[model samples]
Target: MAQFKPGERVEVSSNDRGFRGSWYAGTVVRREAKNTNRYVVEYDQLYEDGSGEKLLQETLDWIQLRPPPPPPEKKKVQFKFGDEVEAFYSDGWWEGAITGEHSGGKFAVFLQRL
Candidate 1:
């Protein structure tokens, strides 16, 4: 029995050793006729040519697919404009200042070190 059904949005593993932790967005098409543990997926952005207009579809093992993550929860706003904050970027925390606030708990920060 497959955990996912047709038309469900999922993230497929890259399966490349160089990018082992990456996943690409795709939609489940159907389970393989001869293999229930495998599925056909249509990738969201992959293209068959350099024109970047066609989507690429491929068969993938169930172990390489996972349901998309849920939307992030909104956090209470704690800092106002001009407040100094530290943001994580490039594998390190960098000093920054909150410059603007956007909808959905997003903030526009200006990092002086960048």
Candidate 2:
């Protein structure tokens, strides 16, 4: 049987009707056991068109789990003079070059180019 946890995103296999290759995206809300080898999953559908629907508690032997993307790498503060660095500004993080530095190694970076 497929193992699914609450709050996990899942893709429901296409319906037996003529539903084509489309799959429904939903969050697993409940699970029930039938007999000794089958599982019934209850899912809440989240649609792109701002509509939601609840499945009638379907049973399945397996479910696919899609992992979330990795987080971005953190920027290090160590930089030498004239080294390119991305500066956080009012607009957003902008690429810039370190123009000067203090005696304690604090850098004064200027936006060399957009």
- For each candidate, give its TM-score against the true structure: 0.63, 0.35
lDDT of 1 by residue, 1-114 (tens): 447899999988656654444567789999888989999999887767779788889998999888877775797558799998756543233457899999988888876641
- RMSD values, in order shown: 8.6, 14.1
- For candidate 2, give the lDDT: 0.52
Q: Indicate the residue-level lDDT of 32 in model 1.
A: 88
Q: Where does the lowest 10-residue lDDT sum fall in candidate 1? A: 86-95
Write one digit per residue (lDDT tens) for candidate 2, span 8-68: 6665543344432334445565555454333444544432343445355565445432323
lDDT for residue 89 in candidate 1, whole number 0-100: 49
- What residue pairs are clashing in model 1? none
